[model samples]
Target: MEKISYSRVWDLDKVFIGGSKSSQFLEHMNRLVALVNILESSIKSLITPLSINEVIKVVPLIENIATIRLYLSQANSFITCLLAENPRDQEAATLRGKVAQEESRFEKELSKVKKIFTYTKEDVWESMLETEKLQEYRFILNEWRENADKNLSEAEINLISDLMVDGYHAWGHFYNNLVSSINVNIQINGKEENLSVGQAINLRSHHNEEVRKEAHYVLESIWKEKEELFSKIINNIAGFRIQVNNKRGIKSILEDPLKKNRMKEKTLNTMWTVISKYKQPFSSYLERKAEMIDGTGMKAYNFWAPAIKSNRVITFEEAATLITEYFSQFGSELEGFVRKAFYEGWIETEDRPNKSAISFCAGFPLTGESRVFMTFNGTLLNMLTLVHELGHAFHNHAMKSVNGLNKRYPLSIAETASTFSEMIIFDAAMKKANSREEKIFILDEKLKRSVMNFMNIHSRFLFEQRFYKERNEGIVSANRLNQLMEESINEAYAGSLEQPSIYSWVWTPHYYITQSPFYNFPYTFGYLFALGIYAKAKEKGKDFEKDYLKLLRDSGSMSVEELVMKHLGEDITSEEFWEKGMELCVKDAEEFIELTSS
Candidate 1:
């Protein structure tokens, strides 16, 4: 174990915190002013030379701008949690908030500088680093620059970016505020207590079925009453996005996200093709889950109920050893990363008062370090979270070499390494199960996730697609949104987890985040991608392991298609890649079903 302490370092660290104080903020402000002056003086040189050397200098300079903003945004993230944790720390919080604005301004200026570069695929290849180590990344760099057709005109792009902060994101903020503060009239354990929607929704995971049911009713009832308002918000936001996409000459709403994600249409199609094809295995797994509950009919509330195999509990320390040992088999580097995250005071995961009861891995974008946040109380799921966050940390470590443009990939790729890491740990544990009970527990959880990751996430993606399409035509009524959601859910989870998931809205943050529309498909994408990669690893054994690290390294560089092709020797645009991956899930489901039946 490592010694843990509180940090009041924001006001003190000039390295990361600039705008929080006059001196610190002035330092960042001065850097911005100086950067602008340098850029202005060389304006003629940039357009005139258009030399490859100029692009090199400019690219790293852009990386520097990104690095500074990344660090500052991460600093603000801590302040955000602090504000949430202690409402009384108003003065410091106010200063911290201002620094966030300064960071945003810095980002805008950096974008302006990047825009000046009339880059081409030839230029990116020409401007790249001369290293045997990274020579392979040249094609990746070239292809990315070649995709600039997707980039909108400078003025329109800037306007859209700015509008996002005040216009689109504001609605999301409103939703968060409304849900967070509103006291819902909920009857809990025979008493009517004013409960927060988030707090009430959490009850759905409780062991007491009645308590979960009541919480669901109260929360759903409240949300139902406000459905009209939420529907309007969704409609307006979707319309705004469509209008922007149309102006950009982007044919589909999905195209913008796909391009923004640096992913190819084929890779996304490959994923859906794979997911939809595997509906049978997923539904079967859900049937097994349904059998565990009483006459509840595998209702939405029951989806979260513990499967027979999920009742095991492990201490945090035990989880650390499990994850570390499992990943160590892959390589020494992964093991060391896990050790640093779990035992070196790098993670803030204790159950504390006034702390939000949610778990997330927040990267300190400046230091290339990440903090794993969760309230740990020694459950099987908690252990899984411990492994999962360490996986995220390892991913940050993986991209450390590509500290420039390749580090920020799409959300689907964002979670690939983490979930892959968890799978590594989970598989290792399942292999070690010594008894029927242990095997069933591990198998049950594993089988259940295969369904949720593929089927449930797939459905959410469908709903978002339909919702966006309908919203583009006109403002969809609240009732329409409900119908869309229900249709997608029922179609995807057909004969799986009850008619209505007590979970559809309660288990997710997607509906509330009007800013990031269609935030659901990434889960399925990452899961299937990882599963596919994992299967390949099994076939090639140690040989595949060598190239696996290479794929993770280049994840920061190329589009999803290029990366998959480079490493996996498979095209991601076709359903074939996904089909192979989905097949592995089916294999696992068969094994689990066989074990349980026997």
Candidate 2:
């Protein structure tokens, strides 16, 4: 593990003062705001299809944005972490929501400017479709026009976009509240107490049977109280989706996300079909796991419970060493970056109250830096998460040379590098295990993730598919909503589930999330896509690094199929593509089954 000094690693003098907001942060705020406003106005108000004049006007604005974003990196981190530490603080909460809402408005304003210029004029977009140096930029702009026609009209679009704050997306905020403020009815050791959502959930992994069961009950009861609220949230959002979809001439709600994902319907269908075929292998591992734990009917909540290495804890220093040794086999560049992220204070890992209960990476183009934030209490899984976040940072690092416009890959492919890095680490763990129990545990961990990336995500996609379909028809009732949610789980779990899990209540917030669509499948797509690429990298030996970096640079610039073809010599939107991807997962499940049985 990397023994990183908290003070030196993050350069606290630059970002924060005594764990509070820097006194001078607001002084720099106006310039940043002014820069963003100018860029938004200029980009949106292109009067004549963005000719060379318009294009030139954009370069400086884009450069300014890069600068502002870079400056905001640590500042944003400080504010977000501060808010996470105490979400109930009304002032901070309001500020947090306001920033997001204001950003949303700015984006809309930019879109309006685009609409004024384009406004159903095909030539406006097509005119610059072939521009050199920004060919990828032009491709995406034109593609947006093709999609806009099939979207809602201007006034209606404006209304729906605004309504998202109080309507669909508010539900997610509500869910966040429920999770954040949730307090257990019982106390630990007979003391009056409460659990932060992360700590509460983390307790369920305890080896003590009584604690696990108590945590289990606490989770179910709290979620049950808000189930109806969440249910209505789902119904309302689904109902809205249905109405809007039909008006936009959308054949299915899936169409937009598919296009946005840069995939074809045929490819998605093939991918899910192939993924579902591997359920038996998952079942084999699941049954073995259940037997080993002396449990029956391991349900959804049990999904995260530790089957091995109970109550594990380690220092952040140990985690870094394990991360370095594990990643060194892949290539030097990645290993070095992982090392520096710690030694350089690119990671924020001190445990504190109200810090967000999750870990994420933020990329800054101007500084060419990626910062990760999380509390490191030291566990193997914590180490894995460190690697995972590093995966995101490395992904951003590869694209540092590209213009920011070409660096932000679509959501579907965003998980590729992270998942790839994780697999490399997991494989390293597998090789170093000294006992059958360790092998079983390590392999089971991989299998658990497979269930998540495939089965669980597949269920979410199914739910969205039906929710949108029914919504287009009209508003769905609460009872009807529950049925649809169940059906989605039924289809995805297929025979892998020994019994039905009550996580149907847990899915309420996802339906209300308007930030993206077909959210579930992208994770599956990213994992498989990365796996397919990783397979080739293993075969290519040292020669793959140059191509891999080039591929990352191009992810945001090209369509998914186009990017895959350019880098991997195959089209992603084919049955042949997805089939090859799931092959390794099946092999891993088989290996898991053998080890567990032995």
Candidate 3:
């Protein structure tokens, strides 16, 4: 293959011609609305304890609704891209509201379908699933049936869905807009410059200690000023969830998250138990890092600082080439897919104001393609993020041939491909390092990521768990929320940091996401799970590639436990499996300490 030219900006024109104003997009949305109306009408005509003939008729409608949802998702993804490029785009924001409205309508219809599935006779439902058109969707169909038992009446669910458009989901949208409009002025090299929240966050990993400190302080202060408003937003979001859970007779907040992840409570308990036992090595790593940086101890901002002084700037071309070349060593199919994604304008990496401080890969099922969004700053961390998102893209590619309903994987397995890709890149960089300083730099970066998955994410999970317990009683005050956050961080980190980020609850977007609750633990789950998968790949060599692809393809169709057993023959609910993953992190920390000590 010839050399491929790269562009930091992605191409959305190929998906839809005119940003948010495209006629094609408007037509697409209009058609989606029409299809949704047809689906609702068809579903409404069906009776409880569905007859075999009625079940046969509804199967086609189910497929139609799935296709409609895919189109709506594509529209949402495009609008999200537009807003990321220009957060102040009122037109794009309006389009987002339109998409949300359609989503609400479709969800109400789905609630009706769920009710029908819940009430149908067992034999009839099983026979229905055995039909030619519905066999591929048996997993999701059964999942919906099981979930329906935990929900309220169909009418009540529809009311909740309708109210949430301006209630629960509106809070999430408000938070996004507020984040985009926030900016701070800071001095850099004797000159002052204004930076958006996203831009300021990138400075947290700057090589200069003073720059990192200033950025942290300013960001914290600004978040402090807005704590009252943020407190209300978070309180209402949690309050809404708690009320709904209480109505459904759900006791613990973790129930919904665990069910959505297809994870058992025992497995979650086992993973945390294993993590708690392995915290010492990470704490020791933190102490070693503080000494290398000549600090009394590690601070919250210093967590991402480079231990050694290196200002190597990796260009977009170099990052792309390096990622693809490293990826090929594992699987040529993945390598080819990533190369196509890069050259085909499937990523948006432009560093600009008003962009969100998050990176993600959004898949479009209608087109069998994915779009990645991030602000690349030429750091090794940024390159790793690029690789991570592409891993999600590859996962999407693996499932493109499957039916849409069976392609809905949970958050636990979603991070597997991305984290695995990051590991490959880290190992490749370590082998290619030419000096002691470079090797330490590579290892330091890898350990930093491990520390985050183990400690920082653990803190978020702990804080949310406590907040929900208190929220069940009444609204939690802003000051009390801060104290809870500090308590959680101190406990999670085992008192390693000089100071905790108390106002983190005000700035972390994961807490405000209405769709996925308890988003914190999934990253930890994916990290360790991918580590286990990577270890297996090493043991099996190149022969594991086909099995790996099969695992990705089946991620959405089974429980995490069953998926692991089928692919790797391991029981995830055991401490031994989680311990194996933690052992990898322990080895990294130990190696880093030994290298730097010499």
Candidate 4:
């Protein structure tokens, strides 16, 4: 109702008065450390195979630990915002390490708790869960107990947690630092200028063909120069994970990711099978895209290039207005939440140097708020990304009142809200386009997203799958890694692209994440899952909004198959469900080809 001055910089002062130097934040960390120590002591002193009375006592301790972890997460979220705002902030980085140490401490205690649950009598465990205090956490508690079967002894798990602080996780931190330090010098407008990796990557989508080509060439060269170092980082990271999984008697790397995603192997297999069958329309779309751009075929650089030249740049205010307007079309609750986020400075979109290239939405359970981080360059794609992150924020908002443990949704479903948001805006914008070029531009953007989810992400998934298999035997050479990447990309794209990104493994951050393995497939899963939900919304109209919110609320507490069955009444492990989603993509690709033909 009122005009708000949109600021690019987020307001972190309200969350913590000082950035990394905040005494309040330091005090909070100190309190968290003390609580973790208490939790560890309590877990250590607990008697196993206890009576019902002891179960009640342990439940309260679990609740306390959860509360303490929430506060720790709040601290971590604040430090993440600071680091993203200014990557060179050494103090923030130091705080991050401290937070990691505290997290390790908490996790060690949690392992002990899980051990207790693993050994507890089923009757007592069920009775404990039936108690009023533990009723809401029954799902997550049962899940933990079930997963504990896959874990090592409590002592071994604690040892792994301790070692990870300076071992596995350290490599991930090093990779981030190396990525931040990357600066490329490329000729723009006949003058050479330095660009951060984030800015250089943004140039891949530049309207000018030559600029995009140069950016790609320079980036490839830079990564190639540092390939050996990256190779070691990735090898060690994978090596550490492989050893851990081996110790746990885990047979495949996908087991961890599948369990974490609450998805079955059959569902993953079915989805890929469906995707493999539907590659023709997407290939046709790429062929048409190349024809429009006067290129012989699609190349790695041309992957993100705009189909038509348009000088229009959507500002932050305009992007926010567009998102809220489309979001309101779905539900007033989402619209109101987004407006509140905007007015409260919950998003950081400042286009500045020394910022992380990745975009994320960090939720603070302690405050029941979320912070979105991204570098906005005023393109339609950037607006869509903003909407995507806002979707995550809305999901967080939907679960704000749920128990902390139940709010830990897997990465698979996490993308549902964000991708759904993107579809809403893209669909609305397509319908409102006033010219052929505008329509093409919007459609191209939409198809670009689909290409990314289906083709690009698939390549990463394939590369990781092969790399781990080879890495199991021994260390993979940089050259071998490159070959794997290229081969995977070629296959994933179905030989559609003229040039495959061979050195992607050297620069892609997802491969190095220590917390999650195969961080690639969940994205495709989420994109397709959201498409299915969007199609349902179209069929059900405004009536679906209530059910949609309920789905978000239940996301953290159920398996992928169970959640889909309960919410959408479809079996995720079936080809019919995946085909429905793939059909939507086929329609878009067919429409794009038909339009461009004219």
Candidate 5:
């Protein structure tokens, strides 16, 4: 019944004194290049032997590498923000090319460092860690040594890294451009209009059933036209990954992601096993949700359809206040970061052309600051996303005390703070709901998140695994990908859906990233993991917030398994721990069913 303007575009002046192509940025780029050259030259003398003096000499080089990476992150973050606002910016794209090229060189230099660690004797390396300064990076140093057995020759690895600039990573950029440039023609209120693919997809959450279904159909049809191109991009990326793994003598495809995620296979298997037990409950949740929306139980297109149309609109200012209020209950630091992000132009929230459809928090480790990008559309989902990214920013903020090497965390635990924030905000909203409709609406939102993490993400995880296995043997056709996606969705959703989301492979972007493979399951892991932490917070009240921040701070310095055990006194390798998180979702599904009962 009322209008709300939620657009608050960010100011990038704080990040760089000048814009992306400013002389300041160009000078920073020159400095980054010079640093890489110096680091490369220093790598020649980093040979292995029983010399404490050589070890000491290598420390500063390691620090320089970290410093170079910090500058690269700032440059890349600024470029990403610029591109998010205008995908067609050639200067930004060129700058991205330059950054990637420089990063490849840096990776080569770092591999040389890894080689030195690989060649060093166990006793010598252990003795080096005895120093307090070096001991601070024990986790990172030990990780490199442990994983060195899987590394190929330095020349081959460096070559692969170089090729990746225009080879593997190029496909990801191509996919981003393709997705941004796409538009679908749809009829809205008896008038035909052209909308971006993202705009069309958002209509899935529209209050009108026909509009939602049409949007889904139009999107599917559009993606079908580009199915061949999408298939090639994904298959090629998989092919590249498999080739590297084979050369490195890696056994299972999951080995790389597991190691990078800092978890044992037992832990991953245990979590997935717990998730499998909830398929039936999710079926019931979806059934009740569908019944509330329409007579039909569940259909693929209507999966995101709204339950109730509420006149409530949350302005960006109100969203910020709500997040700050909720986070302050945990601690002032959490609240302070949110407030600073709003005041310092750390967030870009305007709805404008060529802006990125997704939301992400980009952390500049060197500066101890993060930039969040999201286009707010005055919806509850948008607010939830704001808190989610802020959660990520908060995680980055907690790591400011640590060195650059230790600030890099595994993807599995990276979602902890974001999901924890989401739970606090959602629960607060539920408590403040003044009517049954409002309660149902909030419940549906919560249930939808569960189903997505449990079902959709599971399907994606399955699809990627199957695709990689098939790709390892031979190239997979577009049709085969569709078949695999369908089978995966059907299995994950327990045949509850009327039809499968067949084109999901084309719709999702995670598969394109070269740095992180098998990125789907981490969402499920983070959702449940954060829910587990949220349970602890509920039990301990404000006291647990201190421990929570501690967990975030130590994420990069320790393994996920060790971090959980040390902080929560829980064993992640056990099924019982994961069951605790599964039960939280199960409780929500059961409550939703009861609320909608006849």
Candidate 6:
């Protein structure tokens, strides 16, 4: 069994000619802008109650725009990769600016078509859907009309899109840059060193309890200094969104995110209702883990505490073999895809300074390719992240033949495949543990994530809901933000911690993104959704593999509820479906408590 080594950087030439600065890349951008102009011109000339002949003429233009947008997506992925590898790359920064401008222009042009579709009477729109050339795009075209109905006017929508570049999105970028610039000076083993925000935060999971506490205080002090700036950033972001929602005739703040997620409000509410009932098991697990660490119960800092240290550094090759081996039990298709991704230079795993500390998989549906970015530190967590990201890549691969428009699934369903892949690796790790200590360590790790995905994420969801509700009135102050966060944590955790991470909202970047409001709950949604699917896999054995792949493939073509019901034969809009997922975590929590106390 020869172990295959993974590459530190992926090949972008597969998607585009040369690199970002290449003449071919420039040509692609120019052509995309030209296509955008043409599309806008063609759409603006169209009249309402569009005849079938007019639709036929317009459909080709829309398809051309979709093709050009695919090229833009490829270029965007390439620029992000370059920037992620070296944040100081001036070339990458320039290209990112250009790409952003073109994307805004392109989106505005696409909105015009949406406006046309909105104005078209239902019979006319349905008649257009029946056309042979337009039938493939029925899902996308229909969705645009449904969304457009919520807009003020085509002119206003375009104005907002243009303003968002400097007004809305600029705030998000500023927060990112501001956070990146701050460094915490921490003394590790009596030697003081300045650590980036991410490095300092990771220290909370350090094996030494003292180090974890020191890291917590250092991070808290750093955030405290910027609390005022963070407060303004959040308030303004929320304020901008609220204003937009109000003008769009949306009353509830949740309306935008729920719509974006393609999930019913009742479904989200039902999921939370079930989660509230299952918090005690997680609280008990946290308490026991804290008790094992010390006589004291859970402390705010101890939430990230590690199990007994049997730490061993793994190599990239070993991680690949381990992941591929476990993935094979699901099916050889997944095994083969993981192998191809590694061998074909679709994964970037460089461990370097200034590299982004996050991991994401970008799907290039037009090219039938996907790229994964992550720093591999060879820890168990890193291995889990590898498979987790690979899970996302696999999902993208499943949808290779899906229509370009249909490939864009909501965030709630996006995590389904990744979490499913993680379960595979996690179950394998637990089975392979060589000692009682190792088993406890594995269980603790699993319990810790369950606590995070369920309780911690749930707290953020609650905090954001309250923050938006209050922000609707006016601006929320820094002190009030901390109070809201702590209140959410206290209620969600049920006395699991001595105190909450009061300034947690100050650091989390999700709340700052203008494009994706309420980004926290999707994680919980995906985790629970995957758990339900994973349980089905266990019960049905290998028969579940085809159904799982089919679910992933159809993810983009339909809403989350439709995707779930069509494939799994379950209604996601009910408490019964959500309760099954919640029970799995509670069961894990009970097992964790029993093992640790034994």
- Candidate 4 Cα misplacement greater than 4 A, ranges: 1-4, 149-151
Error of 6 at 373 (Å): 2.4
Candidate 1 Cα deviation (angstroms), residue 172:
3.2
lDDT per residue for candidate 2 within 98-170, as digits (tens), equals 4555455555554554455455345544554554544556655555455654355657766766776666666
Question: Distance from true position, residue 296, model 2, in Å?
Answer: 3.5
Superposed Cα deviation of residue 22, candidate 3 (Å): 0.7
User: Which candidate leads the pack in lDDT?
Assistant: 3
lDDT of 4 by residue, 158-245 (tens): 7899899999999988898889887889888899978788888888888888988999999999988989999999999999999998
Weakest 10 consecutive residues of candidate 6 by summed lDDT? 350-359
lDDT for 44 in candidate 2 is 60
Taking all chains together, each candidate's TM-score versus the true structure is 0.83, 0.86, 0.97, 0.97, 0.96, 0.94
Indicate whether candidate 1 or candidate 4 has the larger lDDT: 4
The positional error of residue 311 in candidate 2, measured at the CA in angstroms, is 5.1
lDDT of 2: 0.67
Ten-residue region with minimum lDDT total, candidate 2: 5-14
**Model 6 stretches astray by more than 4 angstroms:** 1-3, 12-20, 149-151
Tell me the RMSD of model 5 versus the true structure: 2.1
Identify the runs in model 3 with alpha carbons over 4 angstroms from their true place: 1-5, 49-54, 149-151
Per-residue C-alpha lDDT of model 5 across residues 192-284, encoded as one tens digit per residue:
877766567667766677887888888888888899999999988888889888888997999999999998999989988888986899898
Residue 75's C-alpha lDDT in candidate 6?
74
